[model samples]
Target chain A: MSGPAATEAAPAVERWTPLSRISVVAAVAIIAALAFGPLVLNPDWVDKLTTLFIYVILAVMWNALAGYGGLVSIGQPAFFGLGAYAAVRLADAGVNVYLSLVAAALLVGLAARPISAFMLRLKAGEFAIGMWVVAELAHLLVNLDGLVQGETGTSLIAMTAYGAESRRAAVYWLALAAMAVLVGVVFVLLRSRTGAAIQAIRDDEDAAAAVGVRVLATKRLIFILAAAGTAMAGALWLATAISFQPKTYFGVQWTAYMIFMVLVGGLGTFEGPLLGAVIFFTIEAWFGGSGVWYLVGLGATALLFSLFLPRGIWGAVESRFPLRLLPVGYRLRGAPKSL
Target chain B: MTSNDDGAILAASGIHKRFDALVVLDGVDFAMRADEAIGVVGPNGAGKTTFLSVLVGAHQPSSGRVRFRGDDVTRLPAAERCRLGLARTHQVPRAFGGMTVFENIFVAAANGGGFSRGEAYDRCIDAISLCSMMSVANRRAETLGLLDRKRLELARALATNPVVLLLDEIGGGLSDGEAGELVETIGELRRRRIAIVWIEHIVHILLQVAERLICMDAGKVIADGSPTAVMSDRAVIDAYFGEGAA
Candidate 1:
């Protein structure tokens, strides 16, 4: 049905911002520079950057889960550990290690479907703790496997066959590629119709349902994506570190780091978690030697950000600059601006 | 159960909704023809909102059936019902706080109406313009004042391209001038041939647009007729003011 014509011209909806356009160029340049990191950076720095990539993957996945989907899972380490184990089993069966990483991610993503069906029945707090229980259960189940070797851990022996320098460089490239691909996937998803539904679910579930958003289905999709993404990060971490201990892989500290990173960067914004990961990496690199004091400092910093900068650094920056580097929201042109 | 032989666009029969031991709606039956504008009014605790909830599939009736366009929709979820051309607004606006006003409407147009991106954009522009929300279309929904929030609520529902729209107290907490504007916009919706079931406390404003009126009390509809007739009904007057006052 036609609407009554307005006295003025109809407003046009614009998607891209000036900063969003510049961000595209900036992202390309950054990825290209990072691609050359192994060639110029020292071996130690190369390895550190690979580790940093793992952190980025984790933060981004967690942000998508809690920030967008409104599913605050504290049990992501379950999928992370499972991914590492899946890769280990694949490598043992003579699959190429690189191929095993991708396969591991896909397998974990599929596994999350049934789990999400059960988990989605729960509300906010119940879902969060339920995930932790699921993660603990996975840790126990993995411990039962002979290949896991009961806390002694197992090395990715296939990785040992390659020359040290070439292996490090190749692994670095793989980590970089995984991070880039996952981030791109999330970006594209957020720009789609499904992305709008996901954020709508986050804002208010009942209203979203009334507005015709398939809330459960959308939440399940995000849950699966997050599971697969986190698993990819875990598999990459396994390759870089060259070892997998169920205890360490399934440890709660991974979830803590994810929370810290996402909280410090920004919870809901696309660019927030990325910036959070960088800030987190810098802090870890600088003060990791402080041992126990470092842990205290990290906790203290996250608490301060939560209290004072509740929106995180990116939120503060956006409020001041009014720019969107990744504009998922619409902008109406030819409309009177709000005071 | 009431039969749908009258060619009603929407119908609900014998709807009984109970929360624990308390009954919010007791054997409530309602039917509306295509493009019919009905206004629901009742005193506090009269179950007006609860009946709307049951009709829109937000709250399932303990025992009853809901049908839309000759299809059984009692078992369908709210989203499914919305996609089937049934949409609703909450008494309190529930706009997506992080999104702009335009995005809120766009989402409904795209998802509820199942339109392509271009069509959804066109639908959004129509809904926004009809609701007189053009000036603040780019502002975040959370920043909107009460009147604009109500407008966003109506616009979002309109964007769904609904065959039937259920509004729960859309005029609540609005000044007389603000509500008058809403009445005009709603009148425009009626002209577009979209059936509306609006629940409001403002009787005169509702009377201006409602072709039929239903007054409910204590989980039962006490009056159902033309606006003037329902307003003059002894039971409706008694429902509004305590018993024996009429």
Candidate 2:
């Protein structure tokens, strides 16, 4: 009889997940600011940091799509532009400025349903290039006059409607709250069955399908979810800037900057984007004047990350500690083996 | 004499398949009775695997209808076929490399076998037990050896609780002793009343479990009879044994 199984020791995984540690700190820090930052930091600096939080949200959205879904899209500006437009239009029509951003975000993400039907027909590389073309078309149409004042753009005129500085500060807080919620939603989804299926698809599609996963539906859902969340980020961005131009609203550099952060920090791991975002802001502060060189260096770094460390920095870190901080799966360690 | 009328669980009549210009299955007809065990054998490029593909809904035949329990299901997707109690393994094992062995079995049990999570977890243990692989359940599939891999492939398929199982070369790369053990396990499956169409080159193992044997050549059934009679038939000998003469 195989007496008590000769137990080979189980592989050691993570003691604590990077996902939990990072997100806890991030959320607590943001909430702490809402509770106490007004007492310590200068209001001007707080306002600037709030704007940066919007960028963090954008990077998180792109990371969810590319790092997790294996979709490298260079044209997220289409949703961002539409979202801002939706926010401004609804506000012009008497909706609350804050409500407009939320509505706009949801609408832009939902509007992509018909578009995804067309986009899904394209293969991997073609689909990416197609998004670029679509973004350009969307930008052109919005600038064609009679829609949100076309080329002249639209302005909220905060001074005329209410006290300008206070409204601006309130909007900053609103933007901060939006980023926190979006990040939480994405992280939760990533740790669910849907997240597991997407991760499996990222590794290999045919294998995922053989296990009874619905590949297309999962991808489409995430794509739309990311798009909508990104749209909200765009609305808040415009709200903070207090000005919207077709060129500025539809800038490709927004996607470029977010991709750089995602690649530098990590793709699949949660903390990578935040880490990358901080690194980016630091570099921009140091090398403020070397404009094109900043672009060149950023591009080069992304290339290196893609070619050499395809898993990203956090991926490298996690390999040493295989235990997932976000332990979404309920594991069943079968009965103790009898060797 | 080979007709089955006890509510043919899966029936394929006048099925033909072609890959581009190369004709593969030429008007082949096959059927699985409620609990019959049949083995298919053929030379290379003889459409044996192709027949399984058509039956499992992995590929569409150029022509001919497929019926499951008397209802036409010729154009269903592979996963849907699995949901309807049809399961198959590849000629080469197709285990998901990134997944754990237990996770793989869990998928087969839940998604294909129509079991709940608790039930899937239960069946996964049973599947691992059947393959004698409880020791390596937590290991990644890419780390498994060839013999264990062959065992895993059948165990996963069996985990699907398939009423009509299509196995392609299940015994191809196994050791003789392991193959003997597998033949006994498959014999156990036969006794449990699972219809099987096992395609393999290992004649003796198939002979031990299959009540009927089919020889396919040029996408058509060349010989169909009792295992000994089919093996002894001159055409079967000429096509299979003739290769050794060359």
Candidate 3:
């Protein structure tokens, strides 16, 4: 308050950290390796990794909505179910399964605009439950469709056109591509002006509004984007499993998994969901055969994380180290040396 | 009704706010010219904060109109009002805990001022420098002490490039030295020609920067005049103390 003594000579501010730079190169190498996963790894591992990619997509989108936007939606399965059903209907009409997956995801994203307008009116607990009601309603509506034969469900029979090895590789690559694109989208968004508004809204809605942040608009954007990303993951899951059951697609259990992964990984950090998805995939691959016990173990781990490491695994690590794999924050440093 | 032709930058008339029969504000009417610094003093429950809220569009009045620069902004949400150059700081600092101080100010510059990235960066730097917050610009806002938090709140509002800044008890709990520093910063803002409506309990510090004063009692303006004249008014004295004592 004395004067501008300290800021008279302002130092430069940069966004990239040392670890973030290394992360970029490492990420490229890892993604390149994963691209050839079907050829290098066994078909079963390929299938598992594909499922892991889907988990990453769902976890990242959920984190964006709940962690960044402060919109804790327990009804993301609404769009997920809609996407699966859209893909199924398209496939049944003789469209290519892969094209149906992409188209269905876009269609669901569009559908989310109106849904978000209504859903965003509810806050906190009401918003959470309102989304669940929407998912349940979507499930019932899909049941009424003739293409969806009630509880018995239907398969993406068009997928039979591809050979087993070809299908597995294609689905793996599609899931990987979707995961990469969606994660990139979220990353760039958080680095943008709108991303700051979203985080501000999450921190304090009234204060954010007082500061001129368009709270409802920012929340609505995140809601629609999360819906689209979740739908893509759902469509990819259908590709891998080749089944379209409204009960399965619209089940509340999907949202439960998303919450578990995000909470266990890190709620708000960019790298948290990725770490969480990897840990979740490892657990599911190892103990998923244990049935109800697997679910119980997941619940317990989530509880432990929430109780002790409330910031999640990546959050705990970030607190200890000056590392950021996906840095969306700014850091001040000395002026750069002249070239 | 106050017309915009008279050169009032912000004006509120017939503001009646009630919460289930509890009238917080009763037909309060006020106006401020461009670049004028007005201090508001009142006893407890005088609805000073609610008045600021109504002006900033944070709360809707039961039956009233608020005009900002000739536009009817009564129905506008707080964010839209802010983007139109109406910004405020809370009595209790509401810094975004998860963001760094610089990020907090930058958000106000970008979103509130609707500036481009480069412009926002420059505006944020200017605000931080003016508020003497450059030392903790990169610190997490949640980690700041009370004085720093208050400075951040002021800096955030300044970053919005507001035509009128509504400050709610920003100097309330500060030490004498800290409050003096804030007054200096606010005085600098006055020189820059940003109109300020500061509500403060510390009348001496309020008098330092404010040429005009308005005293409220029971949600009505009991006195409004020059700082010394308003302070000496019988109504203000009676409201602050008691009728017989005054």
Residue by residue across B1-246, what tens digits does model 1's lDDT show?
Answer: 777436999998998999999999999888999969999999989999899999888999999999899988999999999999999999989999988898899889989999999999989888888898887888888899988999999999999999999999998888888888888988888888999999999888888889899999989988999998999998988777758545
Task: Evaluate model 3: give its TM-score.
Answer: 0.96
Instruction: Give the poorly placed runs of model 1, Cα more than 4 Å off.
Output: A1-10, B244-246
**Pairs of residues at least 3 apart in sequence or in different chains that clash in candidate 2:** A5-A338, A5-A339, A13-A323, A14-A323, A17-A325
| Residue range A1-339, candidate 1, lDDT tens digits | 123332265567788877789998899889989999989999999999999999999999999999988999999999999999999999999999889988999999999999998999999999999999999999999988898878988978888888999999998998999899999999899889889889899899999999999999999999999999999998888998888889999999898799899999998889999999999999988998998888888888889988999778998898777778887667777676552
In candidate 2, residue A302 scores what lDDT?
Answer: 85
TM-scores, each model vs. reference: 0.96, 0.85, 0.96
CA displacement after TM-score superposition, residue B164 of candidate 1 (Å) = 0.7
Worst 10 residues of 1 chain A by lDDT: A1-10
**Clash number for candidate 3:** 0
Candidate with better lDDT, 2 vs 3: 3
lDDT (Cα, 0-100) at B108 in candidate 1: 97
Alpha-carbon local distance difference test for all models = 0.90, 0.76, 0.89
DockQ list for all candidates: 0.69, 0.30, 0.53
Q: What is the TM-score of chain B alone in each candidate?
A: 0.96, 0.94, 0.96
Name model 3 segments beyond 4 Å from true.
A1-9, A334-339, B2-5, B244-246
Question: Candidate 3 has which clashing residue pairs, if any?
Answer: none
Q: Quick one: best lDDT, which candidate?
A: 1
Candidate 2 per-residue lDDT over residues A50-82, each given as its tens digit: 767787888899998877777677788888888
